[model samples]
Target chain A: MSEEVMTPETSQKVTKAPTKKVTKRDLFWAWLKWTTAVEVPVSFDRMQALAFSFSLNKILRKVYKDQPEELEAAMARHVQMFNTNCDWGSIIHGITISLEEQRAMGNEEVTPEIINSLKIGLMGPLAGIGDSVDQGIVATIPLAIFVPMALKGSILAAFIPGLIYIAWSYGWSWFLFNKGYSLGKSSVLSILHSGAIKKVIDIASIVGLYMIGCLSAAYVKFPIALQFKNSNSTVNVQKILDGMLPDLLPFALVLGMYFFIVKKGPHYLGIIIATMVLAIALTFLGIM
Target chain B: MLFKAFLVGIIYWLSMGRTAYFVSFAFRKPVVLGVFIGLVFGDVQKGLLYGATIQLLYMGGIEAGGNIPSDQGLAACIAIPAALMSNLNPSAAVALAVPFGVLGVMLNNVRRTFNSFYTTYSDKLVKEHKYRTLSYFSFLIPWATNFVLYFTPVFVATYFGSGLVKAFINAIPTWAMDGLANAGNMLPALGFALTLVVMGKKQYIPFFALGFYMYAVMGFSMLTGAVFAVCFAMISSLFKQHDDDEEDYA
Candidate 1:
């Protein structure tokens, strides 16, 4: 099953254009426009359709300069409801650009249906993987490391994480963008199915999980301020708990929340409100 | 004070505006925003401290599918400035940030709803072949709409709401204040736990347990923890590769 999925036939059927109209500068401008304005024109009806079309507007016009009817159709097609993870979704744009370029250069095989289906099919999986890797690891682990330093009055520490995120996003997205453009759609499938990407994701997951664990231990704070009073002496319940395990309450608190999420789905507002109310109630009862 | 508030509003717009999303994403984190907000208030260290404290609540704030769990940028932009003006403690500042974070989500929805207008307008431009004007409608005009949606509340809150927050904080009793602070501390767990769920690898949970206990036992710096994490991951993957190789041979 794995082998079948991994090995797609590597056949390059599309004939190369004798002289390409779409230049390197055109591709660069398309990428720049896509990256900058992808999220700006987002709406409820069509999340990123306008921005996606905006990125390709000039390029589509350039590609089909003589064929105004085709250009109009292409423009109309791109301005449909399109949404995905911003950086990882660049590959979709690259593929779209290439397919459009080919169709303009008169590749009859690259149908409009093919272009739309490829985009719709690819966006969800890429988004699922991209959101986890980008936000879960690249954006987060740095915060886990540097936030403590920022607390200790290091301003540079605060900026470093953001810088790391920016660099990774731009660098990786641009790389994928170029790859998608050069490799075209079929190679993208093979690349997605490859074991190397899977291994990379696995490694990243472990690292991300480990860092989150450390972050939870260091940051999540719940203490048992409760105590037992006797006539002769007073017993500190928190101290007794601490003797058994340092940060026991905090650990339990984090796990309890985790299980709550697991069982009840992500109704975060309720959880937050419940936590605040419970904390306040516990404080009132002198048990927190 | 008006000028400072206006500057803060602009910062909020820039961070939440989603213009050059990569840059804005980096700009929006409370810790980063803390420095800028602090600069406006003339105390970088305090701002950093406040921003970092509030940031803990949102460490795992993953906005998957363009749906934000909470608006951390809005939280920081409002709370940091108010905390700066009113001399609120770090934990209290965190407590203050939570509500605003929630509020920011509504504003985001509103911005999205407002942007629907542009979609129809773009269709009109495309029909008429006014391609040049369509480009403006796609980016600049929608961005300008966001400036109004994102910037005003922050400006008003900073300029007018700071005094109100100070008054409200003063009115609240000491016990409740302590409770709020305690709640603030506990809230960070939500972020971490949410990340765990999103990671969606139930089998790798042992790694999380290992990391948590390891940190609890020997409180290392985050950088040190990362080094250990990378090594552990690499070693584990190496073992997995061996297993895969054996399977392939079979």
Candidate 2:
């Protein structure tokens, strides 16, 4: 299967001027359908497959307008198991659309196998990179910066993080969608392998880590209620701890949870239940 | 009150319904939902406070591969109104949000399971070459299904559950309430800690320490923290680039 893909005949196709053209309007509608419907029909088995076919249904019909048999085959092909990070995976849609157009325009090298392989190949990496960069950095850091302001009674601040996220996702997804259409398969590999993206991820990690710290300090509360009673005076444990490190308990709590996740591997429900039980028990014992 | 519950139900559906996925994703944040939910309850300030507090517990709620770790939207929608109606403190409101957030993941699973029917339907449509009908089934039908799945519980909870929530709060001893609030405060750690795990770079743990201790000592605004963070990241990246250049030279 791998050798078939690598065979010289199937490697690259020469560009031909004669074509069934997909106009900008057609692509826009396709993208619109994609963005809106991508997750709507998501299932346990096929995932976004129905939505994937739904988005391409019109485009497929138009491209294979002269070939009804081909159009039906195309429809059947798309509604197979499909899932990926929505915005980042727009590139896959772009690539698929362009490839279908080429195949419709008589590019024999653009086989069904090649298209399916490309989608399968690209989705995982893009999903991994997209989820972390988009959700971990873009969606989160803004919330860290703005939610405090929202807490302080600023209505605009409440919407700003979300606004930034919406803008970034739409803008980036649309740009990538077009980039995929024009550049086809080669561009994604280049973009993925590029040092620029790595640098971006590195910087995002630093900024994200730092912001998580700031947020942790600002948010996580673990105040100790223990006190040392003496003949002369009572020493407040919380105040003494505050005097040494203002949010020491919170810091330790965050570290404890982080290490738990690292060791136990993200069993969040267990962690949450344990934390609740522990807090309630400590409160019962007058320890926190 | 019924009208408000209905509107809040719509908000939940809009946010979690997966329609216009990115826009819905933004709208679903507790802070954002707080604003809308506040409008329904006629107390934007109180709603924002409760919502923002709840938001902290979900700050790092990354829905990687479309599997939400918790449903912050459901948590906020259900808990905020109950908190407002009962006048629960923000910390206690956060505690109220947690169980609802966990419950929401179950609804998501059910919705996904229910949607499996569409796959078989879509396969038939393609075989029959009924593309138009397939498109409707793909988006609109599934979305309507989600409206039922996402909206009903929220509406029922908001309209009927608030009274129960208030009574439940009243029945609980003050010590238990205080403990719940304390738990609320500590729960934000889970979000941040989860984020640390997701960020997945052990070497950068120092930056987190720097940010935490810096904030602990200086206590500057988040924007100021961001500026400092960016600068630190840039300077470190510059050193990294220099090392890369030397490696190229070697």
Candidate 3:
């Protein structure tokens, strides 16, 4: 815990120019430390990134202020380190520095447009990646396995999901952190454009989309109470069509709820409450 | 009330990761917490199973943006202890757990407001930044507040009269207990739908469909579903790669 907790060195040492030392253990611990029990997704071991960014910025800021012949080269070097280890959060952090510059230039008012853009723009991609990797795959996959075991009376079951989630989520963080710092932006973007990255994304999309569909089928409820009579035409309401469909009903219900939420936003909580109340009432009525 | 509840809450939080993790505290996985409370109160299996089931019923079901009031923490820390100690139906335990946990959330906010209340006194210290004293005061309020509020009640609940508690809950008919268990089991299913909405997308739709179909049709367990999914994805990926190679030439 002492090793993992944000030490003062992480924040302050970077303010003063420091040597760039990267280690595999540093990357490993950075991921493992941040992931211990807390479910704060999208935190990029920022202290580590912060320290690294500080050194790069301190050197670059000096060079840029001097506007030397090697200014572009210096900026390129810093940018290279950044691009290699660059994550979406670090980009935003870098952008924050840019905004501060804009402010210092005497542009007093922050534009509503910039705020809106950050919200509507950054949120979608963050939610997409977070939901896909964080909640959907990492959380869902492990919990899916470990939960039943917990139900089956295993004290050790809870740790299973905890372990798996910390491993995958933090592992990705460490990998990306080191990669971005080492590779720099140009190479990473070039890699992204070079077909290898696209293939990975494509593969991810295929698997990710399929898992979402499966989640939809497994989770959503259609409530397809049939109104039709049986072969005797005796006013029997539970018709054959109710159970015949594999996932059509379930899939539709989740989509319907999603659309409802889209249309109404947080009001759906009320709907859930109402449904729960009605369900309880029906149970009382013997019609559930 | 404060001191006992604090002890209970501490035990509850520590139980979340079963002391595996120390940062920001979370051992809310029901099975682990349940057994801990059970052993502390003396019924190993009941506490384990009770805690775990309550945990499952709300698996990954987060109420983001403050829309739904869920008592996952209370369900883990408080409800299992209350239920197991009282010899109440496990299902009844879950139902009661939610409201209690919600109560805890509400209480937590009130305590937060009290800390805000203490902020009014900060003006005198601000001139010097009284940096060391200010920092100490900040810790003292929350620690003192939570300690006094939770510790005693929890101690009382754990130490005495769990079976005496059974009598009060037993007044509710067995039919009601059955209904609660039925309802509680079904509650987990309700969350799966929301989780699906967040997770589903066009690119990987087939594997999920395949997984669900295998579960519904072939009667596979989640483990089997996961295994089949990995197998299907790998095989399909190979074929897809081959298809792309053919298309490259054509």
Candidate 4:
């Protein structure tokens, strides 16, 4: 394997300007609480709006202490239409809170419209990237590789994906949040410009596809029991297929099912019933 | 039945609440649920086997964008106990879990619809500037909604439905049981099919072919296949980088 693991180009220079009253310690506490309880009160109406506001609750309170009307407005802005891929989306939360802090400290340039626009604008793009990388690759790869072992009755194997997931999700989320908080608005530009995140995903996907292939060959079993008697040779059809290409039946079965699912619409129940019927019919014919 | 009912209810409620991540990570899996149910019923090994078996049926079920294709958690919660009480093997348990998962999906829709009412109420609270009472709508109302949605059905089913399931299992003919087992055997293809649908791209066909042939023809282990894949990824990445360098100069 290649030894190169390219890290994202995160800007190191920390800008010290328009320092706010809300301490970093307080923000840290809220962020920590949010990590454990982000989806606690998840509802369809606000989606993750409640949790988003809840995380910034302390900062909001301190920033708008003297101005009750401003505090109410801030709270109201957070409770609006808000949902995103939670792990990567936490960075947006960090940026939003930092901007809010600056605005509350009477930064004339940082208006309420800018803050709302920032949240709304970033949510969609971030969600798209997060879903493709986090859900599509990171989550899928581990399950594909480890689930086979788990099915084979290894307790330790079953635990691997869950452990890896918790660590990966929390670790990246924490780093992104810190980066966004310290770097403020510029962090967004740096993250986008680096181009390293996309490369990493592309490479991971190559491995993901390969692993899915491995899973199919090993796990998706379709052992044929057909036989033929010709002259002195009583030939087993399954053995002939295996000699030419191992797991041919399983491979064909998977491809057939894949076409059915993708083209015929992904009604899993219908596919299952169809498979059951096929299995029973083949068994009845003594050919499977 | 009463004890199992209470347990299932608690697990279901947690799957939708604050500790949702934990529930999703550890408890929601059919394998884990089986072990827990087995411990409760004094048959840990049986539970483990059944749980693992049923888990394969729902292996492809993933919740993306809050849309649950199938409710594996609910399926596991109900199926494990039902299988345990009825003395049905894991394959039949899978056949049983399918409908429960479907029912759970419908209930999920109902929960989301019900939660919309609270969303409207939240809007009202925000307009009124009742910041203090906002927690009532966000935290209290939705939390309560999940409790009602999840807890009631699980509790009632465990208490009353187990006996009926046992009778149903008793009535199933031997050939039908064999048919169910055969279906169970074929189910993993659907799982792989689902994963393929998500990850499939024409450009990646070579990698898929390499993986399949490496394992099937060369008789390589899964670990070996992964290692080979990584090597190929690295090699391809380097070649691409070389091409980029050439383009930059040109």
Error of 3 at A148 (Å): 2.9
Q: For residues A246-271, write the lDDT of model 3, one tens digit per residue.
A: 65555554455555654665443454
Q: Count the backbone clashes (under 3 Å) in each candidate.
A: 0, 0, 43, 1
lDDT of 3 by residue, B1-250 (tens): 3444445656753432111222222245565567666776677778877877677556645333212234465556767777765666767787656445445545444444554433433333433334334333333343455554544344555455355446646676654544444445444433544544444343444565565555555554566655565566666666665223211100
Model 4 misplaced regions, further than 4 Å: A1-20, A36-46, A132-157, A221-288, B16-18, B172-202, B241-250
Question: Residue A245 deviation, candidate 1, in Å?
Answer: 5.0
**What's the DockQ for every one of the candidates?**
0.54, 0.56, 0.22, 0.38
Candidate 2 lDDT tens digits, A1-288: 011233344343312222357888888898989999988899999889988888888889888877888899999999999988888889999999999987986778899999999898888767766776788788988888788799899999999998899899999999988888988887777876678877877788888889889888887889899888999999998999888878888999998989988897867777777887888888988889
How far residue B64's Cα lies from its native spot in candidate 4, in Å, is 1.9
TM-score list, all predictions? 0.89, 0.88, 0.62, 0.79
> How would you encode candidate 2's per-residue C-alpha lDDT over B1-250 as one tens digit per residue?
8998999999999999989999999999999999888889899999899888888888777776677777899999999999889998887788788778878888998999999998888889988988899988999999999999999999999889888998887888877777777877788788788777767777788999999999989999988998999999999998885233311100
**Residues A1-288, candidate 1, lDDT per residue (tens digit)?**
011121222113222323336677887888899889988999999999998999888988877777778888888888889998899999998899999987886778999999999888888768767877888889988888788888899999999999999999999889888778888889998877678877877788889888888888988889878888889999999899889988887778777877888898877777878888888899989998
Best by DockQ: 2
For candidate 1, write residues B17-132 as lDDT tens digits.
99999999999999999999999999999999999988988887877678777899999999999999989888889878877888898898898999999997888787787778
Assess candidate 2 and give its lDDT.
0.85
Model 4, CA-based lDDT: 0.68
What is candidate 2's TM-score against the reference? 0.88
Candidate 1 chain B weakest lDDT stretch, 10 residues = B241-250
In terms of lDDT, which candidate is stronger, 3 or 4?
Answer: 4
Off by over 4 Å in 3: A1-124, A178-243, A246-255, A266-268, B1-6, B14-26, B62-69, B98-168, B171-183, B200-210, B231-250
Candidate 4 docking class:
acceptable
Best by TM-score: 1
Q: Given candidate 3, what's the lDDT at residue B181?
A: 44
